[model samples]
Target: MTLRDFALMVVVCLIWASSNVVSKYVVSHLGVPPLFFAGVRFVLVALATAPWLMPAPKPLWRILAVGVLMGAGNFALLFIGLKTATPSSAAIVSQIGAPLTAVMSFLMLGETMNRRRIFGVSLTALGVILVMWDPRGFHASMGLLFVLAAAFLGSLGAVMMKQMDGVKPLQFQAWVGFSSAVPLLIASALFEPGAIEPAAAAGWRFAAAVGFSAIVVSVAAHTAYYGLIQRYEANLVSPLTLMTPLFTIGMGVLFMHDPFGPRMALGTIVALAGVLIVALRFNQLVSLVLAMRPRAQ
Candidate 1:
């Protein structure tokens, strides 16, 4: 990749990472209901991208399943978890998705995993466990569990997505938006009484968060990342995106005032290393390094 491409990728990671900080503020400071906030964000995304909703992806049921798992199931858990969870812990724990996917694919699709992969998987789990032992409190542990559940759902959705066809990035977002929005809105209304009014009263914090998550993070940043993935090897793109979590942890400490210490750092390092192993082949790693180097004379 060229310098410009590298910069674009960095920007993408920042946009993605900053979302955690934004969401933490929205749920903790503004006191928005997690599910309701997620519902509203998707409502806007669905409206904005409604054009792609038509000519629905073939095997409509599969698309719907992906939407539910990737959209409603994952975000509902994540945002709820964020209500109590620090952004830093959320960042580290979410990395478990790579190993979770390996497990899911092995069980669901009969894919094979070698010993190295199994060790990486185990390492990922242990790292998450270590993070959960934080001295902060039990609520943080519960929040960690919620985010872990979200990670599981996301991994399962990724496996399902592999089975899908004819779903463009924007089109997939359209499906996720439409499929997730209604049920979430319904659930939020039923369970989170008075959620909407508070969002309206919260003023710019709520609106800014919604716009940033729905449009900038999901629509713009995700699409840009997908474009890079399409142009480059998956391994190359995957490792670079790890910057998102790293930055999220930093932003959590800097902006959200999330507590960070050796425990969090150790857990993050272990979890990310495992994710890196799961995501990249040795050859791809070398290629990625070469791609980053300046051309020789």
Candidate 2:
């Protein structure tokens, strides 16, 4: 990747990290119904990207399936999980998606992973197990499980996306928005009784959070990310996103007053280390090292 693309990836990570915190606030703090919040956010995304929906990409069913899996299925579960899961922990657990994506790519996309990558995947799983471990047992486990399921859905969608063609970022976002919004809204109405009132009571804060999530996160950050995914291998792009959990942990502590005990810290380090190892090819690692060295004087 060019330096410019690297910087852009960093920016996207920040946007995604910020979005996690904001979503946590909306669902956990503001008491917005998770499905409702997710539905509305995607509704706005659909409206914003509606223009790009035209000349709809071929294999319409695949596009819709990807939209439902990555967009609605992922966020719906994630928001629901966030109602109980802390932003920091949720962020860490979400990293499981990288390994999941790697596995899926290997199985579905004909990608090959050597023993090093396999070890990295195992290490990542161990770290996530540490993070998900709670002495209290089931209290937080259910929420984390939900997040794990969300990651599975998202990873599957991403791998499926790799098989697709001619789907621009905005166009993909448009389909995701539209396809996700309808089902999410319907589910919210059916399951989350009195969901709308609390969101209405949240007033402008709710509006602002949804707007930021829809416009900045789903549209700008995710669109840029999709473009990068198109331009590079998934493993190459996935490692850089480790920055997101770091940013989330900081913001969660500073803004949301999230607890950061030694266990969580260690888990974060281990998990990130594993993900970094899994995602970086030896050549990429060498390049990164070379890039960090002093330039010719």
Candidate 3:
């Protein structure tokens, strides 16, 4: 990758990480209902990518399912989780998606995981246990369950994503936007009475959060990240993107004042290492270790 590509990758990571902090503020601090916020954000995304909605592409039902599972189920749960969960912890827990995707791929697509990936799954489970080892008990931390559910739904979306064809970048966003928005809007209305007026009057920070998420993170950052994926090997791209959780932790602490303890620190290290293992191809990983070894004289 060139310096420009590296910089773009950094920008994408930063945007994604920062969006978590912003979402926490919007949903929790501002007291805007979580599903409502998600609905409005998707509205912005839908408008911005409206042109892509025109074509009735092949595998239309799959596209709609992917959109609902990913854009709606994933974000709705994540936003609800953020209401109680810290951004830093949410970021780490959400990474369970990688392992979940591996499992889904194996079952649905008949893909096989190597021994390294199996080890990676074990490591990820250990890391999660460490991270969630609150003396108070994890059952009370229902927020973690919500995030994990989101990760599972997202993994399903990824598996279904493999089935679709001829979907462009903006078009994918279009499907996600439309499919997620309507359901979330209905949910918000059914559950959150008198929400709209307060949210509308919440002023600029709320609007700013929505804009940053819909335009910056969902649109600009995703486009750049996807471009990098197109250009680079998946193994290389996946590991580098791990910077997102680290960046999220940093933003959470610095901006959102989220706590970071010893267990969380260790868990972050272990989980990220496991994800790296899962992401890299077995042969590529072995080659990387060999290359890094000291050369004989």
Top-lDDT structure, candidate number: 2
Q: Candidate 1, residues 54-89: lDDT per residue as tens digits?
A: 898879999999999999999999999998899989
Tell me each candidate's TM-score: 0.94, 0.92, 0.95
lDDT of each: 0.89, 0.91, 0.88
Off by over 4 Å in 1: 135-139, 283-297
Judging by TM-score against the true structure, name the best candidate: 3
The better-scoring model by TM-score among 2 and 3 is 3
Ranking of predictions according to TM-score: 3, 1, 2
Off by over 4 Å in 2: 1-6, 227-237, 286-297
Candidate closer to the true structure by TM-score (higher is better), 1 or 2: 1
lDDT of 2 at 21: 93
Q: Which residue pairs of candidate 1 clash?
A: none
> Cα RMSD (Å) per model?
2.5, 2.4, 2.2
Expressed as tens digits, the lDDT of each residue in 159-180 for candidate 3 is: 9998887777888889899899
